[model samples]
Target: QEAKLWLPSAVPSVSRLTVCSVPVVETEIKLRQYRCFESLASLRHYLSLWTRIVLAQRAKPRSHHWSTRSQKAFSSVRERADDTAERYRRDRQAILELRGRGDWEQRLQVLRNEDVLSADPGLL
Candidate 1:
């Protein structure tokens, strides 16, 4: 009778349930592993993207054109400054000739008086 009970066909209900639950446990474990791998893949993608951006910023200009452009810009600015200074010098020379020996304030006062006297009295 004991040998008959020990046969595979006569296994206890508890052992049968344990055998059936094994596949469910294995499926859960596989699902967890898949989630972990997905998370790692996402992290790797972000890291690569960040690295690309940083490297692009750190990369130096490869051509001489950039330096040439900067030099041209500086020369143009210098030319403009020199032109403005020359124009100012010419204007100052003209003003000095017109004012003679008097300072600018005296010249301005005389000019203002002359303008008042020159205006037509009828217009006022």
Candidate 2:
């Protein structure tokens, strides 16, 4: 019998915003110059827009938008995101605290290895 890894689903919903029609290349200076916006709010807005564009690319990611390897990488990311969100409702604060420590990847690695710990572990 072939044992399948209990991995997260392959497909997760992605935001629809990509730069297929528009050329979206970045040079370091260009990015740094743009990052120098006078107001943080304006910079944040640009970042937000860029995020949407990237999300769109992920939603419909393909060789047209990115390479096959990149698309696979994005899918892994999207699956992890879904897993985190789905688990957060009950363990939100604990998750946030662990994330804040900058050891989030390490902690989540344990989750990837261990059994789930539902917090009403006491009565059981």
Candidate 3:
């Protein structure tokens, strides 16, 4: 049949043979190209949970005595969380700037050549 004859050509044999597993690093980097709504939604949900926790903890009566160490620990935790969120924001911005309608396949291939994904550390 005509379909049978064309099927062989349609699926390039070389591409099949060359379909080796991508390195773990390259795999993660390339996966970022695909939009993930579920992850974004989950992140938003977690952020909301953290906000609620902060509010609830604030409403709770503090022990009559507050230790300096406890205050320092709480402050450190909040600062670390803020820093993490800022890093994600910057990373997203850097990725957008690097993309600028560029070809993902080409960009991925180039990235694989070096351990570094982008000159900008944000992509890391």
Candidate 4:
């Protein structure tokens, strides 16, 4: 079936080819050019087949093509998260150190008072 469909000589003469009883000149020209039994239908089928193959290959899980922009974005997000964690660690360490000091309570009281005065309109 496939072999017969692909053979140019299998197509009837131009005069005999018609679409809905109307003579199709362009289709006749294409049929003669390809020398195929069913020029338009065969070409359309082949095109669709190729398109599906390409799409399937692209959709495969392990066949991802990671672009540079996506890689850069991933690295940047990871770096930002690392930086935030490091900053938190450093801030926690400073607070722990301050808590261990002898005058920590006094300093804290003074800072609290200053903060309250700055935030309270009545104190000003």
lDDT of 1 at 86: 43
Task: Give the TM-score of each candidate.
Answer: 0.32, 0.24, 0.35, 0.29
Q: After superposition, how far is residue 51 of candidate 2 from its true place, in Å?
A: 3.9
Candidate 1: residue pairs that collide: none
Ranking by lDDT: 3, 1, 4, 2
lDDT of 1 by residue, 17-76 (tens): 455464644443344334434533443443344344334334654457855765565455
Q: Which rank order by TM-score, best down to worst?
A: 3, 1, 4, 2
By summed lDDT, which 10 consecutive residues of candidate 1 come out lowest?
110-119
In model 2, which range of ten residues has the least summed lDDT? 7-16
Error of 2 at 78 (Å): 0.5
Provide the global lDDT of candidate 3 against the true structure.
0.40
lDDT of 4 by residue, 6-121 (tens): 22122343533332232344443343433322332343343344344334445653424544444455445445434433443343333333233454334322122222121224
For each candidate in the order shown, give its overall lDDT on alpha carbons.
0.39, 0.35, 0.40, 0.36
Q: Count steric clashes of candidate 1.
A: 0
In candidate 4, list every pair of residues with a backbone clash: 8-35
> Residue 108 in model 4: shift from native, Å?
18
TM-score of 1: 0.32
Worst 10 residues of 3 by lDDT: 110-119
Stretches off by above 4 angstroms in model 3 are 1-53, 64-70, 101-124
Best by TM-score: 3
Using lDDT as the measure, the top candidate is 3
Candidate 3 lDDT, 1-124, residue by residue in tens: 3544322113343552244333532443344443222333434554454454455456774664544544565565545545444444443443343333456434323212232122233323
Q: 14-100, model 2: which lDDT tens digit per residue?
A: 311132111221232233223322222332343344345455565775675466655566455445444543443223233332223
**Stretches of model 4 off by over 4 angstroms after superposition:** 1-66, 101-124
